[model samples]
Target chain A: MVGSDVFRAKFFSLYLPLTLYLVFLLFPFYWMLIVSFKPTNDLFDMKFSPFWIQQFTLENYLYLFQNTDFITWLKNTLIVSIVSTILSLVCSIFIGYALARLRFPGSNFLGLGIFLAYLVPPTLLFLPLAQVISELGLNNTYWALILTYPTQLIPFASWLLMGYFRTIPKEIEESAMADGCSRIQILFRMVLPLSVPGLLSAGIFCFTLCWNEFLYALIFMSSGSMKTIPVGTVSDLIKADTLFWGALMASAVLGSFPIAFIYSFFVKHYVSGLTAGAVKG
Target chain B: MAANARLKSFSMRDFFDRERNLGIMLFMAYPFFLGIWLSLTDSMIGRAGQFIGLRNFVDLLTDTIFHQTAKNTFIYALVTVPFKAMLGLGLALILNRHMRFSSPVRAAVMMPWIVPTALSSLGWFMIFDPVFSPISWLFRNMGLISKNINFLGDPILAISSVCWANIWRGVPFFGITILAGLQSVPQELHEAAAIDGASVWHRFRHVTIPSIKGVVLIASLLSIIWTFADFQLIYILTKGGPANETHIFGTYTYQIGLQATEIGMGAAISLYMFPILAVFAILLLIYLRKEQ
Candidate 1:
């Protein structure tokens, strides 16, 4: 081990810069929280320490609840995210299992194909996807987002889960198979339980991606009442007409809160899953 | 190994085995093939979109605005990608070492990545707001400049402002992933290097970097793809404005495709990104397989 002297040197050199970077990273959330709570007067006034929420008020949330379709957007986002995440997880788990365990024909290229499919970003696909959505008669509907989202989400979650399943001992399945237990039984009874952490990680990732998607949501959902949280909040004309800064910030806070909560609480899983899925991709 | 023997006996996986290839084919069919086909047609504004045989691609190539957007996207990637890579690696190095309260500090550092970017972008845009911007207020009181900076309004600031937000949103993932990379380098090597009186910079250059070089490359390529195609941060902050100066492939495609009803050109604009991103994706896949 390095001497304590060296450790101290490392600490000194690292902390100040780390703290500065931490501040930069956390500032937006802090600012959003402060602005969300601060009264419009304190928000506008230079006298207020931009850092502090001097005149704390619920007026922004109140206005958001009372005047806008914030609740509707929230619900729409919830339904779409939940459905898409579930679909992605189921498909990803099967795909991951097939690639990891089955050793079926073309599994290698199939994995490569999934990896390549993932690289096709939504920004690139939305135009053609928009045409597809319209042709399918799914335009301006929740089904459009729910259907198209998995095209992106599955590649990520499946790749991560594939890495996960490969790490599980093949011996376990071998013994179970020798015992004459079916492969499906071995997978459902043995493998699924072991991969919960991975599943959770992939689930959170799918949920986050679904929650955060903007382009497809904007393109596919056009009606005011049909929009998910991001598209509804950003594209809607309320802020255009009134420029409701307080309500806008409040909406931002609420819009971000669910995934942010899950993300912070389960950060370990999130990081590992991301690196495993992405770096391991 | 025994499973490999027994699996051939039963073919138990035959039922679900097709899903992987099937799922992959379905996923590929739309985006890769159908998308390319869509780019070849002029499907817009209630038309059946007949095949125009690369007219859309030619139109976009010849269009000045498309040329400008491509230039801006390249410039934006150049400006943001390096800052993200360096800051991420720097923080990762710092965080990799043992320290007091390191976990919480690292957690805080990663909060921005946790927050949905579109929402957090609103928070930044608020701070960058012209009339009541906290940044402008802070700048005013510093006695450095007497004016509130038009962060999203001025062309220069708009580009840099979006870059700043993009960097803010991006750096944490790189930091955390690179930190993960840093942690993997065995302590024995560092201790041995120290015994030889290898200087800090020398040990880092020779030992630490090479150990995590794969991670750094992977992280940077990922950041490059992310930043290149990103729409949320730029769209939220600037919407390709102060007169479309900030428009990248993502936002520019949205503007022309949906707004102007020029779906074919929009598809072509998006398709232009394929070659560059495909290169990155291929490089990334090679690195990923190496990691495994």
Candidate 2:
């Protein structure tokens, strides 16, 4: 009885701190959700009510959709993120396979270079890149972001795919080559099928990254139609005289849903991918 | 005929190899080479300016804004990295055990990371606003303070406000990464320590610390990089306002380059971030090699 009591005490002691930390982490999100539903007047009222929704309404969501350019921003974000992910996956796969399987003169250096490039923060590179983007005459267009974002995505995807491709046994590819299958065929037929989880994780990561990216969207694309969600949301906020708390939170909740869904759906793979890069590094 | 065919095949292989080399060179040419080329010249504003050698570098050394921005970035990074690491480690230690509803709690903790930073900053901005701050209301209601507190209005508090937003967004990264690390440590170590009458602190220090050192190092390095380069959080929340006290390198570069169109100086300031990031990257690479 005493031993069981001790175990329970220890367990509770360990569990309490984690629970509190989670509360702190999750409170703002919960507050956002509650504020999204609350009427505008109640949202500002200095009442300490927790669950009392004085007047529940979907008017904020309606305002976001009907009264603003939220939909256009969503569409633009989807296009850039999706295209960037697909393009990055294709480039990383070929490069990753080559670096993993083929022994070439500068292959090691190339692999290391890609990893180093991944480490170069976009904050540093964006200024020089802005000049390059302007020179290409792609400023204020979605294509500017579509093209420049790959510079950031490719390096990390290549690094991740290289690590993943290395984990697949060489004998599988070797046997395919022994059967007179070309390297391309082996990659398409043998290697890619085995690395789908890694590819999915990379795709989700790239997609979420491009979706959430703010600086480039703010700088590279200036027009309303071209603005992605992050930049667009902020611009909308700036234009408002009063804090549109309900509408802002509503849009935020909606904007975050897709990535949240992707994260929830692929929770295990995402965790593994993060750890594979993080813990291994 | 066979010897001639073999020679032809060898030549073809060599040609393919050269073509592949050229392809990679072409791929990397823009970012690797073009960036350096632009940095050297002073033709950032228009097409007609000539290459003035190292003038931008010299200007950067003497610029007060550059010095202040660098100081802000270092302070931001130095303050946030260790705090987030410790908080994350503490949370992971607490949550690593078998418990009811652990998965749900884990998911809940990860929601902040999943939410977009701009959106979250906006949310926090409202929460910090003097007019609608629930925190101020709560404090007032409890008689802790007689007036509403403007968290983002003061200079030091403005920096702390941005830090709070960053910490909120960043703590999850440490939690998730450290949780993964904690899971990898064998349960037997803890059990053996317990059987040998070792305290929880001993087991944590001797067992958990060594086991997860690589992860801790990598996660901290990554946090340092991200925090140093972070702009969206500060940009939306404070806009580097309250007397430019919160302007880090990222926001400063954006302000100069994009907003003010001081392209050459902006490019110089932005490029300055490379050396610091390179050191972290080198350490990360060494750690990766040792792990392998």
Candidate 3:
């Protein structure tokens, strides 16, 4: 099977195509970064090559930091994402354990139900959710996102946790039980420690979803200071009256940094979790 | 108190499922039921009015915007799902090959998907800028065209621009998922086919395609649901502009339901997703169950 022709075939097939795909995938982001740094004059000038920016500056970032509620939006997004992640993680841990460990009535159905809930698109849920949030006087508050985000997060987290939980040898739990550990004690000490990768992936998934969330954030958090990163960047930068390309690109780069960071840092866990759904995919 | 101690003594027998049930009830069941109920009633502005049966749905069926959005959403999904599947499979096949830099390449592959969609859409928005598009500049420089193209101003061009963004963002997801599938195909199948004097194309047709068929179906199905419900890219780049030519179901629902304060209609319009998504979800679960 080790053939001479296939060696060259692999290069042409794999390397060339990958390079092209990489360029296609990375170019938009590169363009964003280039535009963000390019001087306003250089940005518009057709004479200057569009691919590379000659004169770069922090003028756009400085303006973003100084002129707008960029910091506030960042803080709001952080708080919402973190709180929602923690909330869903807690809820999912419980559900995950119960579904994985306990022999309760309809546990199987409930597990499948949660998975289906995750399958349900946010479009179908957001309208009724908006009403429910407003009824509780949560509109324009961080709590609106905090309470609602768990709808998606809890299902995803619990499903992931359940999968992780299933992989640990049951004998380990039995030994812990023999060692006089309570149910919760064993879960906290043994299962939780072992499922760190799963937990991290679930948490990252939640944080990413929360940060990227636009529709609900657009609706609930109308206040100038309350927009999440995606909502805030688009509204604050791409206004009809303004249309500052450099600043807009700057806000986009800045807004995407945390998500990009988390995604890359936890790339392993994230990919595993992503492929779990896509295993079927 | 005594019962608690007794429970601890029989920990294996008496573990409570309270925590799990509570989470499901609040997060999954509540909104699910509320969604169905609100779709049936004349609910608006936080007030649940007397039930109006399928009036909202009836109105949606007749609504011109709803009709257009339904068509647009279908078109968007139909176009993107297959492209994402084929391209994803192509990348997956390549990446699945034994390579030295496969790990870094995998990470690089995920970049489009990693960056948030709306943020990337902003990048796209500028790249598609009528006067300053780099693609336009390149074409002009090559003497291919006289001037820049209006990518988002014309309806057909606008749809193409939005779908391009969608496809770009979606391909990585499909690629990795299909790559996972490709990796799982037993080597013996390919080797066996090769030993039978099968050509590379025959080996791929017999061994690769069959092994990855379920994964392709599921991946493309997921893409369909996401693309159909997609609000962000369209919202950020075009917002269904040029006379609402690019509006998908997601943006249309937001416009009518939330922006216009026609909550009943929005809820109803969104409810249409139930049948389509339910079909996909069931198919996925069935295949997943079979896999396990």
Best by DockQ: 1
Which of candidates 1 and 3 is the stronger one according to DockQ? 1
Q: Encode model 1's per-residue lDDT on A211-278: one tens digit a residue.
A: 98888888788888888888877876236756777788888889988876776677777667766666
Alpha-carbon DockQ of candidate 2: 0.52
Query: Which wins on lDDT, candidate 1 or candidate 2?
Result: 1
lDDT of 2 by residue, A1-281 (tens): 99999878975787667667867887777767778888898865656463357788999899888988999999999999999889888877877767666666666787787777677777877776777778789988878988878778888887778778888887676666656776667778888899888898888888988988888888888887788888887888466577788888888778877877778777778777776543552
Report the C-alpha lDDT of model 2 over B7-57, residue by residue, as the tens digit: 224332322355753554454455545556666676546653457777887
Estimate, for each residue in B59-149, the C-alpha lDDT of model 1 and write its tens digit: 7778877887898898777677788889888888787767787656766777788777878888888888898787888778888779888
* Candidate 1 whole-model C-alpha lDDT, 0 to 1: 0.81
Candidate lDDT values, in order = 0.81, 0.78, 0.82
Q: TM-score order of candidates, best first?
A: 1, 3, 2
* Clash totals in order: 0, 0, 1
Relative to the true structure, candidate 3 reaches a TM of 0.92
Candidate 2: fraction of native contacts reproduced: 0.57
For candidate 3, give the lDDT of residue A248: 86
Candidate 1 docking classification:
medium
lDDT tens string, model 3, A16-125? 89888989989998999998998788877888789997997989889989998899999999999999999889978878877777655666787788888778788888
